[model samples]
Structures are given as structure tokens and as C-alpha cells.
Target: MASPIDNNVSSAKAVLLGALASGVNGPTWSMIKITFLTLGVCLAAMLALAFSSSDFIMIIHVLLLVVISGILLVLLNRFLAETGLVSIEQQMEEMGIATKDQIELSKKS
Candidate 1:
């Protein structure tokens, strides 16, 4: 018989693997798409600022700040996405619902 700890580990591993395999699945994809869109808009804005400014030093400063801010935004987005996925999986497990069955039930409902 397996110990409870072992069972929990297995379940956690399964959940993580399932999450990775389902990359950008419905809800996550929506969040990711938003993140990308936001980044694109910010980049465009930075480029416009750089072009409209007369000072070379100011342009360089704006570009550097934009790069750092973009990196931070991407990292935060990734962290939030992972956290959201884990919470979602835990909620499903607590409700005693497997992914496939959940899908089928949702379709039926």
C-alpha cells in the first residue's frame, strides 16, 4: 500500500504535468494573449517616444526602461499564470473532478 505522502506527491506531479501539457489552454491562453498584447502596446508606445524625442540620452534611457519593464511584466505574467493553473488544479482535485470528466460534464450541462 502506498503512503499518503506518496499519493499526494504522485497527484501533485500529475497535476503539474497535466498543466504543462495543456499549455495555453482556454483560460490560460486568454491571459497569455492579453499579456502579449499589452507588451506590444507598451513597445509601440516606447518606440514612438524614442522617435519623437530630440535628446539621444533621453531616447536611450526610455529604451532601457522599457526593456526592463517588459522583462518584469513577462516574469510576473508567467508567475501568475503558474499560480493560477496550480490553484485551478487543486480546486478541481478538491471537488473530486478529473479533467476529462469535468469536460464531459460541462459539455452536458
Candidate 2:
């Protein structure tokens, strides 16, 4: 209901702000925060669904939701690790494409 709407709005705001923060500061951290927040929201949505529906039906829904989310998260994490911001940042740094101040901290490390 209204709660879901409110959660969605706030979550969207967090994502937008996270992007902005990443742009001005650390892209890697920013992307990590955004990804984690998104995962959190997904988990929350599934939990909310359990609240809205109860008994054996709710259990089935939650089980399916968690399974799907776990699979997706695992795959995405692996993909990102294989081609993370660090790699992109390194390329940008080498090419002098990043702003003087926007250099990625993770890449520097």
C-alpha cells in the first residue's frame, strides 16, 4: 500500500544520491553502496510480501523470492568482480579521462 510506495520513493532517492556521491567522490564505493542498497530493498520487498500474505502460501512465496534473489546476487557479484570499477577506473586514469578530482580511490589502491 502506501508503505510500499513510500519505501520505493526513498529507495529511489538513495540510489540517485548514491550516484551523485559516486560521481563527485569515489565511483567504486558509490557503486557498492548502490548495489547493496538495491539488494536490501529487494530483501525488504520480499519480507513485506510475507507480511501481506500469511500461512503456507507466504512461506512458498518467501522461499521462491529468496532463492531467486540469492542466485541473482551471486551472479552479479561475480560479474562485477571480473569487470569491476577498478578496471574501468584504471583505464580512465591511464587515459586521463577522469576529472582531476574524480579519480577512483579503489583504483589508486
Candidate 3:
């Protein structure tokens, strides 16, 4: 017979994996596209400026900051969403796993 702890571990892993895999199915993939667009728009305009000039150089620096901020925001959002879903699923699984273990232990008794 499997230990209740083993079952819980596997259940937790499965829930987290499924929650993560959910990203592949929809607008979750859209994060890359949006981030890329923001980066391009910010960087390209300054690139179009001639002479490697000081003003445009400063603009390029600001665009780099925007790119960093934009990418970080998207990543944090994705991480939090995935983690929240996994947490909810794990909580639900805990109740079901506990009941099954109780029944198994009762049978053993």
C-alpha cells in the first residue's frame, strides 16, 4: 500500500504541473508577443536618430529601462498567476487525499 505522504507529494506535483501546462493553451503565450512589441517600440525610435547623439543616447537608456521594467512586470504576473492556481488546486486535492488516506487506514485497522 502507498503511504499517504507519497500520495500527497504526487498529487501536489501533478496539480502544479497541470497549472503550469495550462499556459501553453491560450493567451498565456501572448506575454512574449506583448513584451517584444514594447521593447521594439521603445528601442527602435531612438535607433532611427542620427549621429549617436547625446539626446538619443539618453533616450536609448530610458528605453532600456522600459524594456527591463516591462519584461519584469510580465514575468511577475505570470509567476503569481501560475502559483495562485496551483495553490488553489493543491488545497482542493488535500481534502480528497486526506479522505482517501483515512479510508485506507480504517481498512487496515
Which sections of candidate 2 miss by over 4 Å? 1-54, 86-109
lDDT of 3 by residue, 5-77 (tens): 3354554355444445442312233444575777767567655553256577676676676678678777966
Better of 1 and 2 by TM-score: 2
TM-score, candidate 3, is 0.30
Sorted by TM-score (best first), the order is: 2, 1, 3
**Local lDDT at 12 for model 1:** 44
Alpha-carbon deviation at 93 in model 2, angstroms: 9.9
TM-score for all models, in order of appearance: 0.39, 0.40, 0.30
Candidate 3: clashing pairs of residues:
none
Best by lDDT: 1
Clashing pairs in 2: none
Per-residue lDDT for 36 in model 3? 71
RMSD of 2: 11.9
Deviating ranges (above 4 Å) for candidate 3: 1-54, 85-109
lDDT of 1: 0.57
